[model samples]
Target chain A: MNRLFHLPLSPFSRKIRIVLGEKKVSGVDLVEERPWERRMDFLLLSPAGQVPVLQLNGTTLSDSTAIFEYLEETIPEPRLLPRDPAQRAEARRLAAWFDIKFQREVTENLLQERVNKKLMKSGYPDGARIRAGSANIKYHLDYMGWLLERRHWLAGEALTIADISAAAHLSCLDYINDVDWGRNAAVKDWYARIKSRPSFRPLLNDTVPGFTVPSHYANLDF
Target chain B: MNRLFHLPLSPFSRKIRIVLGEKKVSGVDLVEERPWERRMDFLLLSPAGQVPVLQLNGTTLSDSTAIFEYLEETIPEPRLLPRDPAQRAEARRLAAWFDIKFQREVTENLLQERVNKKLMKSGYPDGARIRAGSANIKYHLDYMGWLLERRHWLAGEALTIADISAAAHLSCLDYINDVDWGRNAAVKDWYARIKSRPSFRPLLNDTVPGFTVPSHYANLDF
Candidate 1:
């Protein structure tokens, strides 16, 4: 049986879950882990001690990007990346934008403070950080709206890892009620389309202890 | 003619430069860009305003990881990632270890304080950050030494993107005389092999206007 070490609120972990769902890979035993605990056994399995570690094909794989790429190579059905090299690079580029940039600007600021701190029993959330995250997210929503105006999905006509990556981060923020859907109609529309996918259903059903999900999070028409 | 927007000490940019050299890709113009400046033209090319942005095959590409993967797909000579899926995953895992983890723990604290501060005409380097970066790097070097104690290269028996990514960051740190070569014999040995590559020579020769190269910076025998 393929086992996965993951966390509910981790955007990177969420990315793999969506990818797994998109690929229709069933029978994956999702093992929720708190990487901050630094368990010796888990550390042995993943040296970096980050989540979304997949134990498949008799190998242990960590790093969400590496895992995603491996899955792409091993299971090429309904390709997450485009066939053309240029389009594929663009997809990967957009994926990086969310994973690295959006993550640093919005997710880390909002989710890390509002969610991870409470889960880990850490200190109270900083007002400065929350304010910064709130301000930063507006710019990002505008940017996404700008992109979605021309393209059906984040990258192009078809759904790609780019959309999955962005949605993964946005979903986590949305859980904390950080996303302002009214900020950009195009972005909201894009999210609504992706949110309706079967692959994204599992994430909506997830209920993190002590944290309540916003009513619209699970709504297909959201 | 193909053009590349790069910087002398940006580890991400250096990764592309070394990759280009390793592939013997010539006749490309190198344009140095300071992303922090937020230049309108550069931002148009890279919405993220980061380097190294490569204009090749009549397209603009950003995000080092995305660009590297694109180059790997288009130019498959002397593969940087292994053929086997597991090994390829391992290679990418190591690459991210440096690009994300090490970049945060060490490079951002040290280089961003030491180099970027001076270059950007920002305030003086913070003593706290420099000390923190200095302390944090030893742990990473130890981690690399631990890995090198087993594998010939970072990923396995081959010179992969893992080596290039690690070397790119360390090379920048070596410029500021931050890396302690004596702390880890295996890491030093591994670096010696990589630093001696023709691809690495250009990086060794690079000079920033306000910074002097350490005496042993360009020497292969260091």
Candidate 2:
């Protein structure tokens, strides 16, 4: 059986969870890890002290992308990355967009304002950062809207790693009602499609202490 | 022929340049891009307003990882990323270390103090940022030293994308004399091997106006 160390609100961790669910790796044990607590075992698992560390057999893997590739090769069923090289590159590009761009601008900001305060119970929220996040999210939502407007999925017709990466971050933000779904109908519909996936059900059910899910959070149709 | 809009100092851009060189992709037109200028063509190529943006065939590829993957797939011979799934994951992990961890602590600070100041040509260097950069770099250098002491390369015996990623960032930092080579002998030796590579010579030859490379910049053994 595999062991996975993760945090509920972490997009990277959620990415791995979704991938595990998608791949149907049922014999794995999922444990919530608080990296900030600086547990010795966690440090031994990953020197960088980040979550989403997976232990398979005797080897441990860090980094969500690395884990994804490992899973793709080890399992190779229900492919997450495209078989065509160009298409695979496209999937990776979109995944990087959400992980780096949207994570930084949208998810990080919302977490700092909504989740971090509740979790850490310290540091007052800055209006400027929150405002910046709101403004930037609109831009990103519009970009996603444009992409979803054209294709059935974020990367293409098939559901790829990109969709999982995006939904991970958006799901976290959605928990605190930071996302304005009304900004774009296409983007909203796209999120709904991704949200209803069997892999996403666990993510949708996640509830953080001192935080409550929005009215639309558990609603599949919303 | 492909077109690359790049800033010579950018590690991400240099990573692609090395990939192009390694793949023997000839007739590549290199256009020096100032991202701050925010040209419409560049924006069209990359909405993130970063370089290197590769206008290859008809598709535009942005983000170094994406561009590198595109090249690797298009040119299957002399691969940069390993063919084995686990090895590929290891390579990506090391690459991510350079891209995310080292970039945040070292490259970002050095760029702000050294290149960003010159590019912006604004106020004097921020003392705190420079101090933070110097202190943080030593720790990273020490960690790299420890890693290199065990393996022939950063990730393993084979020089993978990890080596290229680390060298790309270090080479840029070296241009501004930000790296303290005397800090760690093992790390220095590892860098020397990377410096001696044929693809890296062009990067060393780069000279920005109002900024001068150290005398050892061109010396391969230095």
Candidate 3:
């Protein structure tokens, strides 16, 4: 059986889970790993000591993006990236925008401070960081709205990994009630569509011990 | 002509430059972009406002990894990624190691402090950050040395994007004389080999104003 070491609340882990769910690749043994613990055995499996380490086909794979690429190559149904090279680049670029840029500007500030810190018992959430996260999320939501206004999806007409990546991060923030869906109607409408997907269903059931899942988080109408 | 908007000291920019050079993709009109200035035209091209934006074949692409993937898919000759799926994953994993982990732990602490601070006029170099970066780099070098001792290249027998990514970050650190190359013989050997590649030659000649490149920086024999 394939094994996936992941954290329920981790966006990167959620991204892979959604990807796996999207392709209907089931039977993956989901093992929740707290990467900060730096368990020696886990480290042996993943040198980076990050979450979403997939043990598939006798291969230990880390890095969510690499894993996604591997999965896409092996399982080509419902292609997440567009066929055109330019479209593919756009999909990847937006995926990266959420993973790298939005992660830094929003997720790190909100989720890492509010949820992970408490889960790990690292330290009290810095009030300033939370404030900054609150401030930054507006810009991101507006940016997403702008893009959605222009296209059906984040990248283009076709649903792509860009949507998966962005939704993964947003879902995590949504769990913490950090995202104000009302701020941008387009972004909210987009999320409502994403939330209804079967691939996103598994994430709705995810529960982090200390953090309460927002009531609207799992609601299809939300 | 195809255009490349880049900054001299940026590891991300260097990664793409080396990739372009490696595939012998030439005649690109190199445009130095100060991303910090947030030129509206550049922002229109790259919403992320990042360096190493590639304008090729009427496509405007940002995000170094995405650009590399596009190039790899389009230009199959002298394949930078291994043919095997698993090997490709490994290459990508290590490439992310440098681009994300190493950048945050080492390069951001050192180069961003010493070089970008001056270029962007952001602030004075933080003593604590430089100390942290200096301390962090040793572990990274040791890790690289360990990998080199086992495999012929960072990923496997064939040189891949993993090497290019690692070299890109190391080259920037090398320019600032932040690397203690003497600390790891295998790493030094690996870097020496990477430094001598024809693709690497362009990066060697890159000069950033207001900061002197170390004497050994451009030397292949160093």
For model 3, how does the per-residue alpha-carbon lDDT over A1-222 read when each residue is reduced to its tens digit?
Answer: 699999988899999999999999988999989999999999998898998899987988999999999999889998999998888999999999999999999999999899889988899999999999999999999999999999999999988999999999999999999889889889999999999999998889988777778788899887
Show the colliding residue pairs in model 3: none
Q: How much RMSD separates candidate 3 from the native structure? A: 0.9
**Predicted candidate 1: interface RMSD?**
0.6
TM-score of every prediction relative to native:
0.99, 0.96, 0.99
Q: What proportion of the true contacts does each candidate reproduce?
A: 0.93, 0.60, 0.76
lDDT string, candidate 2, B1-222, tens digits: 579999988999999998888788878899999988889978977878889888888777888888888888789778888777767888888898888888888888887777877787677788888788888989888988988999988887788889899989888888888899999999999889888888887888888888888998879778
The pairs that clash in candidate 1 are none
TM-scores for chain A over all candidates:
0.98, 0.96, 0.98
Model 3, CA-based lDDT: 0.93
DockQ winner: 1
- The lDDT per prediction is 0.94, 0.86, 0.93
Between prediction 1 and prediction 3, the one with superior DockQ is 1
